[model samples]
Target: MTALFVDDRYRGAHGIGRYAREVLGRLDVPWRDLGLDGTPYAPLDAFRRVPGPGAADVVYSPGYGALLRAPRQVLTVHDLIQLQTAWPGRAKFLAYYNGPVRRVVRRAGVVLTVSETSAEAIRAWLRDDSVRVVNAGNGCSAAFTPDGPREAASDPYVLFVGNTRAHKNLDVVLRAAAVAPGIRVRTVVPAAEAAEVRRLAAARGVAERVEVTTGVDDARLAELYRGAVATVMPSLLEGFGLPALESVASGTPVIHWSGCRAVAEIVAGRGWAVSDAHDAHEWAAAMTEAARSSRTVAAPSDAYDWDRTARVVSETLSDVLG
Candidate 1:
């Protein structure tokens, strides 16, 4: 086991965690767990989590999480959404990305990303036209199959699977709730984020129209996807849109922001409707059409799958470590 796979993000319910969990179990590389206690954005964590001299031949990370001083490492940088979008800690995020995060990516032996859209953003961030950004794409997990126990709700709803990040464009959904009185919004967020989502729903005066939930496992999430008329991924930017892929996998269509090529890249022409996320009426109309849409359960035909992704990571690591 010459490669150390960071596993702390495995506990996450978001795309990063799901990527870590899926790829970690499928990688053919000789590797073992190397958990970092805190977030990779925390400067001090890099110091504490840095592997000592000769700890391993190389290290691999599934997401943007990184070690500042890992001599030889391979990591997935995901997206530069935080840098590209306006957020609460914009200045601090800039410092972290420019400081340690930039160095990590610049120094890494290999950089893997989920989509070409993210790869382009990462290349722009590096400011090096020659920098190679490997796009491994993203896979829809097995649990998100079209055949599943569907969630039954009192009101027909559209699904939103994400945290309350500013870039997530929750405003569109909230606005749609007001514009389209017939459409209900059901959001599934991490447990810690439930309160904030609830608060956002309340503050927007759509608390009754938007139902917030937490700690939904993959099976239940699949059910939710299968039940919803469609999934709404209103994110302004993303490394990759996992929810859209998952939703389409479960035989449901998706309403996504036309601006998000990341989501469009994976879904291809399948089960997707493009609309301007900034326009509430557009979202409302899309949601209305989705509520009236129906589809049959079919296996995902896309080439992206976890096994292939892990194989790509393994090959990249082998090439770097050799």
Candidate 2:
């Protein structure tokens, strides 16, 4: 049976893009791209916008999007962050997830996720035990290791690997930077959000201390990880904490919010978990402690691998197609 994989997700630098690139490159089975590059969640245009996967026995999307009209399709629902958070578009997100997303999962061949934490949440949302929700997990790239070229910096700095999104919880880190005087913060945001992040840092009075960097490739990102005092995973929610996982793999410790279960699950013993997500004082204390502490170190990670992830995905595809 022939398979068609959604290649549009390979464009970005986020977790979904990484998943798409890694798994698609590693898969042993024969497949072709469906050439789809449009928004998959548009309720009205989904059927019209997405091209049909012609002559393909199976269709797959690496992100949390469904080929609503396809006969046999697979999806990777990273997380329901939109539904869980109380943002300005909460009602719209709630309607979308419950309406379009619910119908897709119920009909999908198999639903894949990044962590057990996310899998549990997805299953709970479904309420039906019949659907197959699998935790294919995530992997650390070979670039992020203990022994690597370290990024040079004048003072001790902690790394934050997300944008200014609300769920990314970047505000909490900005708040902590205000009180954590000894430690500098380096926030890596996308080019589109660079100016906004800088403005936010200035508003937070950490403009001098908080460095905003953009367009950091993996090699430079690994260097940044290796030299950091600690990597901060301050996300309010995540399907899988890829940044934290990569940080620990590089021998750098992490300071993550305790509510970030996806992060805490991987970096628990390898770093510190700040219990309060809202308390900036608590985050500041952890940042200060992490800047001074040497309780953690790097290792060539063995727990998660992209090869294994691809194998599971490949197997699932083969099983479902047959």
Candidate 3:
């Protein structure tokens, strides 16, 4: 049985691309890497009509950006954030993610997700009970672990990763860091967004303490996590919180803002979850506690392996084909 892991825009930079690569490495099936080679519309449009001699029996699109019209399809809904926050100018976002995209999701044979929180959000948003939930556990392979010459910095700091999307809730971290003079704040993102993030830090009165580094490679990321006091993921919403899992994989404790179901679902007792309503002092306290306990994170379990995720995809495809 052949399973097609469709990721039309397989640019190695983004998180969705990482998910596609990991799942493809795992599933024991003939796979395809139909990236942005041929496209007129968006890269997603190219995926919608991806062609080859080996037509797949089942297709899995982890990004949820592309609509698969295949006979048997599995759409992984990372989170239903489009319906939740309704951020500024959400109408445009909803036009792309809701309605038509959801119609494609309803046509899927199975709905796999990264966390139960995301699954619940999907079901509640659609008001459907039949959606099946499969938690794709998080893991960083041996390749992702720290090894080379770089080592942890001597100073205490909290790390943040991801773009400057409104939902990332970066303001909270900036606020907390401004009050905590002892700890520095570091962020990983594109250089284009650095000036704006710095403006934000300045407005919040932590401009001197906040440091933004653009273009971080995997080795630097591993080294950063290995040395950090704690990794902070304050996203107001997520389909699955990858940073939380990566922190655990890198043996750095995580401190996430509360209400992100993914963080609670995955890390449970392993890390700290703080309320969004908490003031800067409270968050600083949590950061201090996390730094003190950062060394406790262990290597994640085998279930988090990409191979295991691939095997699940292979089995699902075989069943669909049969």
TM-score winner: 2
Q: lDDT, candidate 2, residue 24? A: 82
Alpha-carbon TM-score of each model against the true structure: 0.91, 0.93, 0.83
Model 2: how far is 254 from its true place, Å? 0.4
Shift of residue 287 alpha carbon in model 1, Å? 1.0
TM-score of 3: 0.83
For model 2, how does the per-residue alpha-carbon lDDT over 40-111 read when each residue is reduced to its tens digit? 555563354345565456677787665566666777888888787776778888777787667777876468
Pairs that collide, model 3 = 26-310, 27-310, 78-239
Question: Which pairs of residues collide in model 2?
Answer: 251-298
Candidate 2 lDDT at 251 equals: 90
lDDT, candidates in the order shown: 0.77, 0.80, 0.68
CA lDDT, candidate 2, residue 11: 46
By lDDT: ranked, best first: 2, 1, 3
Query: Which segments of model 2 are wrong by more than 4 Å?
Result: 41-45, 49-56, 298-301
Tens digit of lDDT per residue, candidate 3, span 1-322?
4546455454355566677667766667665654535432253562355454145455556666544445445666667776655556677557665554566666654566666677667676665566455666444555445343334566689988877877888888889987788888888877788898999999999998888987876777877777778888888788777777777777777788778777766566566788763467777888877766645566566656777766666676566556
| TM-score result, candidate 2 | 0.93
What's the TM for model 1?
A: 0.91
CA error at residue 60 for candidate 3, angstroms:
3.3
- lDDT for model 2, please: 0.80
